[model samples]
Target: MVWLTMFYLSSMIFLAFFSFFCLLSSFFSILFDVSYFIEWDILGINSNFLVMTLILDWMSLMFMSFVSFIASMVLFYSGGYMSGDVNINRFIYLVLAFVLSMIFLIISPNLVSILLGWDGLGLVSYVLVIYYQNEKSANAGMLTALSNRIGDVAILLAISIFGYYGGWNFYFYTDLIEEDSFKILVTLIILAAMTKSAQIPFSAWLPAAMAAPTPVSALVHSSTLVTAGVYLLIRFSAALEGSAAQTTLLLISSLTMFMAGLGANFEYDLKKIIALSTLSQLGVMMSILSLGYPNLAFFHLLSHALFKALLFMCAGAVIHNMKDYQDIRLMGSLVNQMPLTTFCLNLANLALCGMPFLAGFYSKDLILEIALMSSINMIIFFLYFIATGLTVCYTFRLIYYTLTGDYNLHSLSSVTDESYIMTSPMLSLGVGAIFGGALLSWLIFPTPYMICMSLFMKTLALSVSIMGGVLGYLFNFMVVNYSLNSLYFFNYIIYVGSMWFMPFLSTYPTSKSILVMGSMYTKVSDFGWSEFYGGQGIYKVSMSVSNSLQLVQNNSFKVYMLSFIIWVVMIYICI
Candidate 1:
């Protein structure tokens, strides 16, 4: 009891300090408006400044508020949720580090500063993912780090390209790059952002991240971390505008949105479903921002953080109460056991479904309108609309399996209600889901209705919600295998077998060319993954060649001395 008390107080105090920074940033940004930032001039170019000087703008302020509130609530809630656990101190410390890193990231003014925060965030999050230090969590941490490392390599290549030819005109600076070499660099930057944001083909690891603890998931999925891709896009909007990478961004963003939404529906682990849902939503935000409506992406990101954090925490609470069995099929009628958690979960799901009255509605509507306005292709419009439909379906699935289905307590009826520490964050985040849209009115479209949008978008969004609720409810009572669908086998083959093994195989598979003594053409033709049988040939050739070099190293000194003596004799005779 004494240990628990001491840990909670210390955590609360640490949380208070971090929350203060988030609040202070928002408060100052609002008070100062747009111009009140620390503009840094490094390398003779103006850059962003969050470390030394941070200027809070409308977008940063809003997100900072959401981030801080959730940070505090999560800290407070985790105090109770993890109260008696031995890992409590370790968890709280990482939470503090995570929030601080995000604050620096939010307020940082330049690419260098933001990248520093981005890297720190990646580290602490990996640590947090493996907080349980279990085998599953450790694997999740490695996958997350591996993805981030790919993003890092892309970033380094971009930086090199940017620096070699004048550095000032690239994305971080207010100036745009018109030079050919710099244009190539900027293209690499887009690749980095896509990988970091986990778009389309790169998005597989997010589902794997479900092995993390719930609070870690809430923090990562919601505000600062996963949206790092969209955040980078928005932060560097001036650079991407009318750039060469638009076509690439457009296609990948569209694919990410559609694929991730489908992946969400195909998941049964409540956390994995939410994880995929976030990837899909981030995909939507990336697509919208690619069209240069960053404000809308920022808008959706805000609501997404709040509402998704709520759902994750609520899901966590349910798991906590039920002793950590996370299968949704085992979680029917939790409404009776925990009424507050149920209500909070419903509010979050409503927001996620983008019910016209909730927080997600405004953001989702704005992004679609922007997509239509910016895109010339009707195919893009249709793709986004279909993704919206899937979003609704998955959100409702989460709601039904956790709350209103038949009570299948299965001898687990004695689960207790969540404490104040666990549920308070859900309650706070729930309020945001309820009323955050009007507060974030800066992002709302001034035009009430549009011909291309109103009829199809509203009709589709509403129909999706209704159909999703009905279907998820109808199927809630049935016992079914909720594992991967028909494509799971295929997905495992490509994403698991191919991706995991390709890096290790790419080099030696072609080293067969090293062996063949025939002409280069004949050897090149023979090269493949042939168990390096040809590599053995190369090994023999290498042995012969290396022996030749060794003979030189061993005999070169004596040969050079004899040559010198002969040269001296020749010089004397010539003289």
Candidate 2:
């Protein structure tokens, strides 16, 4: 029955056209009632946002437009990309559901409502990531799911805690205004957002996520999923106002930016490099927004969604040409092959580097402006400034290496442009990537500096553009010659080895000590690593505990259940 329904041409038309209609309906809903929320209470169940004021704020509406616009593009692109691939009908259905969830997420009014939309999108992403279900992709999907589920659990706990003290109603966030608990609640929510957004320490999943098909990465990085962090931070803007937590957020964000940019330089996989670069950029935006500038973050997010989407689809085209090979080192000089794909890829990278008159310039420069406001310490400001330099390093590195390398693959020529289903939308996205930043408004912001954004910000954007282009060429040598044995970089063991310098760097040398003479773990540490370390016994004890757990699971379940039943009978008799 499922095959009969989806295999028909008419059914394909209906599914594609139906989702388009849904988008139109959603847009009109935003158009008419977006000023403030008008909601209804559902005492017996969860409150729905549709009952609140129409969710037509500038932010929600803008994101909704992005959802529908890019979604339409992806759907159209998929028709060609998936045409001959096996099990494509299932892919279409999942894509439809994914788009719907994002639209709902955009308009959701309360935390519960937003979570509903958030998890829906996440579930679809998990399905899509493992669509191939090979060993690599399966591991990618599971790790991504586990990391995201950890975030979800934290969110669930925070919501339960808030509901206990605040109210069961989801719309009651406003009810807790000026309360200390509300601030704590927002902080917990921010932690959940950071994990979802792939901020550092939790960031390893994103590179793994590249195992998914390229279009999935396009959608994930571009619109719905990754932006959830910025959305949550912006949505709860006032709650985070005036907290010391902003500085901590800035530090984490800066670290993610630094590490992702650095990691991108070292990775061999074409898509992984871009993925790392994107994670870094998103981290920088989240950090800047947390420091009390949401609009700047919004602009950067908007532009990123445009260019990153283009870059991923174009990369997909390259992979499709090469029969799914991912390493950039093996492929090159396809100016004739996949001309449209190459063009779009370069255009997107240009925008990503924030070249003047491109979409990225408007957004990234705004972030730099916020960083330079002199309210924060000079050291922190310089850190963000340095991050901007790193962004350039990674963005244009892909640009230089991918196009400039001579053909290394055996007997391969550049194919012609992608089919209509692919090329048309790819071209449109490239257009957007080029012009989206050039056309910002003076009236909306209306400041002396704001009016002159082109004159001021564009200049900075051009300089960064030059920096990226120049550095990419200069270090094209380093990118190709990157060695594991030389600087001993990517040797995480070396980084760990260097942590012994902690005592030297620490202001409190005594506090930095890992030794506690009588403590069990320390004694084990001393035994394992050296005469000075003692964690070996602790490791042995942990292994024993793990073996004990294995025995109970294997041999004791029936006995445990029988004992539980006997204890229950004894308790009842006593009662």
Candidate 3:
């Protein structure tokens, strides 16, 4: 136990210090308008050199600071959260490895190095997801691993394409690649990004991945794994500028944002609700990036990382105290018992809803205004606003269920601020959740984005947010006997609640037919047709022939002479 404590403290302190150093470096890089690219030639094939490259720009440095900061807090928090487990050391090691992989990804501009990090993330995340060693964890891990594998394959294909173009440093070749090849490269990169970021068709894993330990979820969902995709696209955003791919990305991301928000509203699991919110925010980042505002996306990514990690940590604390019951229906009036935790939870939730002047407000509000100004189709615009409203709606809904309602857990349950170890991290992140956005905005942008929209357009985001919050709180208000109106629209609720049945769509439907076909093949080839035409048929034929020959032999001289006479007569006729 003493050793574990030392391990946690040392790791946390080292990471915190590193985070600060990176932050300082980011400021210096930004002030000087300079980027450092350090490359070492590892192998050479003619003119094409396989090199290990590291990029230290303001962007990479800033992201590294955020990741390290979050990881530090998460590691510290895990010390308390996993205190009872025997394999806490293993957990700590896995989390550290996860952070290292993310760092590798953040620093590398080369595709080869990025792949090393990318595959590391996928592998480590799968192990973390299945850390609990249960059926749910196993299933979730498989989904997460397999979903990310699609992205890995995309990256590998992209590497091969890059090899054809003579280098793996995509940063240098983004503008130089030919039009047709650029399109293919962009598509592969986008696909890889989509899978990692858990965009549509690839989103089920994000929520399912909540099966991981809360600290792992806090780290993975917030900064390390899911954001890898968005970060990758941000790096490749230059190639995407003014391309048809951006339009497709915009549509897909908008739909993803809308879908996640709507799904969160219907979800009852506390962690799952938060996971869905992460998905929704990911969509927001992706949508903004697709609109040719990679800076805004990066800003949001940094800001969201702070608050989302806080949100997951708060959820972890609640789950930790409530005897592992994650159903929000069983939680209520938490503020009465756990004020500090409840306060942090509310703060994170508000940040998520873009409450004025919070971290989310700085980034989310700008993105919305800029998106409003963009020349997008009505459908995409509608999706953007509706998705934003849904985000607020679900945030308020979660707040009402888990924070404000009547206490629904057993009378004997002891739910309080567990320890300073947990609360300290929450408080630290609470500060970030509140101020991280404004600070990031100042650092990331030299000048503020100029907004020139009509009064109605200016107020539209606020209005929808207000309306969504009111509806969210009011819709869940129940008296002594409230009829379950949701049952009336059961199918619709199930469809939307289940992320348009995405979990089923991603897993079952795609494989169901194939599995059925496989079953048919098994029956036909192995049991029915193969029995007659394959080894079984040959064996049966041989057995019948041998039985006849044995019977003829059993008939002694008479049968043998008769068979010989018949064979001789047939031979004579042939002659």
The global Cα lDDT (0 to 1) of model 1 is 0.72
> Global lDDT of each model?
0.72, 0.70, 0.92
184-229 in candidate 3: lDDT tens per residue? 9889999999999999989999999999999999998789999999
Query: How large an RMSD does model 1 have?
Result: 7.5
The parts of candidate 2 lying over 4 Å away from their true place are 1-36, 45-54, 164-178, 412-414, 440-465, 478-575
The TM-score that candidate 1 achieves is 0.78
- Per residue, candidate 2 scores C-alpha lDDT tens digits across 428-529 of 789879876654323123353443334554455456556756786677666335564555544664343222222123213323453233455645654446
- In candidate 1 the C-alpha lDDT for residue 194 amounts to 76
The estimated TM-scores of all candidates read 0.78, 0.77, 0.90
Question: Which residue pairs in model 1 clash with each other?
Answer: 37-55, 48-109, 48-110, 49-109, 50-108, 50-109, 77-421, 515-538
**Best-fitting candidate, scored by TM-score:** 3
The digit string of per-residue lDDT tens for model 1 on 167-245 reads 4223245354666775676676677677667775567567667777788788889986787777777877777778868
Better of 2 and 3 by lDDT: 3
lDDT of 2: 0.70
